[model samples]
Target: MRRPVAVAGAAAALLVALTGCSLGTADAVPGAVRVPTGPAVTPLPIPEVEPSGSAAAVTDPFRRAADGTALPVLERTPGAVFADVTQADLCGPRYSAGVRGERASDAEEAAAAYGVEDSSPYTTDHLVPISLGGSNEVSNLWPQPKEGAFAAAAKDTLEAHLRGLVCQGAVPLETARQALVQDWRAAYDTYTARPLATPSPTAAPTGGDGGVVSGGVCATDGEVVRSPEKQVRLTCRPDAEGVLRWQRRA
Candidate 1:
C-alpha cells in the first residue's frame, strides 16, 4: 500500500510538468486552443492629436480701417516711401504712368497676409500714392475696397490732388506724404474743400507783403509760401519779436 501511494505521487508530479510544457507551446501547434490563466485586459485609449498646420491655429494680425473705408490695417500699412525718390521724379510726366504692371501675385500675397478669403472686391493699393513717391514694397501695399465710400477711386482723386499741390509748391512733398500716412480721409477733406485753382501773377496776398513772398513778415502762423525767385518753400513761424515771418523750414 505504501509503494502504491509513492508511485502515484510521482506520476501526479510528472503530469503537472507535462501540462505546463503544453501550455507554453500551445500557439506553436497547428490546431490548438489558448486557455486564459488570468483576467481579461482592457487597453487604454489613444489620445487625439491636433494638426499643426490647421488654419484655426493661425492668428490674424489685421484690422479694418479706422474710418470703416474697407482699407488696410493702419498699423500694418503705415505706408512707406522711397528714400531716393525726389519731388522732380514724382512730378515728372512719365513718372507714375506705366510704372506699375500686373500685380496679380502681389494681390494674392496681400490678400493672404490680410486673411481675405474672396479678394475679388479688393484691389492692392499703396497707402501713399506712387505718384507721390510711395514705394512698391509690401509694407506700402494694402487691400482697398474697389467700391464703397472713400474707396480706391476716392483715394485716386486725392492722390492726383496732392501731386498737383506738391508740384505747384503750395504744399511740401513731405507734408503731403505724411498727410496720407496719418489719415488719408482727413487729408482728402482738407485739401478738396476748395476747387483747385492755378496761381496767378496778380493774385491777392495771403497775409504776406504782397505777392508770393518768402523770408518776410507774414500774417498767419503755420502758413506756407514759395519764393518767387527759386520757388523754394518757406513756412510762417514766430521770431524773437513774436511776429510771424516766412522762414526756411527747419
Candidate 2:
C-alpha cells in the first residue's frame, strides 16, 4: 500500500535537517555553510560478483569498460528502494531538499567493492537516486567516476530528466526506477535527447576548485566547481581543441 504523502514528506524533511545533506540544488538554502569531511578510509573489503556468462550470471546494469571497472557489478550493487514511496511524495517541493543520507562508510564500502583504492575521482552514487525513493543500502551504492563518456555528471542529467518525467506524469515512478536499475545509460539515451558526448550540468554545484577560475583550465571533464566568492558555478568541459576548461554551466 502507498504511504501517506504528508507523512512521507515530513519524514524526508526531518531526515535532511538532521543529516545536513540534500538532493536538491546546493544553493537551495542560501547562507548555509557546508563542512568538508575528508575522504573515506582505504583498505575496505571488496565484495565479489558472480562471473559473467555463468549459469547464474548477473546482468550488468551499466555499460562497462574493457577492464570491467567503469560501472558497478550488478551482483554487488543491484539497487534498492524505499517502501511506500508515492509519486506525490516524490513530486513534493521538499522532496529533493529533503532527500540525502549516503554515509561515508557506505562510500568506502562501494569503492572497495569496485576495487578502487582511491575514491577521490569518484562519487559514491545511488543507483536509484534518493529523490526517487532509493535506499541508502550498500546494494544501492556504486563508485561512479566523476569523468568519462557517461560519467557521474551525465548520470545526474539522466536522474533529473527522469524525475521531471515522473513528476510530470509522462513516466510512472516505478517505470523510471526500473529503467535506472536495468541500464542507466540506455535509459538516458531513450529518455533524453542530449548527446552523450556533451557535458551536462550537474544537479548540484560544490565548492573548492583548488583555485580554478571560470574559463581556466580544469583537470577533469564534467567537473563542476563554484567560484571562490560562491557566486558563479562553472563546469569543466572540453573545448574545440579538446582542452578542458571551467566554463559557466548552460
Q: Which candidate number has the best lDDT? A: 2
Give a tens-digit lDDT track for model 1, residues 1-250. Answer: 5999999988877986977664335546767778864322122122222223535335533333345455455545666776667787776656767456426786677667787778888788887777877766666788877888888877876776677667766788888887777667778788755343343434423433364455365554445777867677877543332334566763
Those runs of model 1 whose alpha carbons end farther than 4 Å from true positions after fitting are: 1-67, 199-250
Residue 80 CA error for candidate 2 (Å)?
Answer: 0.8
Worst 10 residues of 2 by lDDT: 38-47
Candidate 2: residue pairs that collide: none
Candidate 2 lDDT by residue in tens digits, 39-119: 232221233434456342244344463444355666777777777677888877556566668889988988787677887
Global local distance difference test of model 2: 0.67
Clash count list over all predictions: 0, 0
Error of 1 at 28 (Å): 65
What TM-score, over all chains together, does every model reach? Answer: 0.52, 0.54
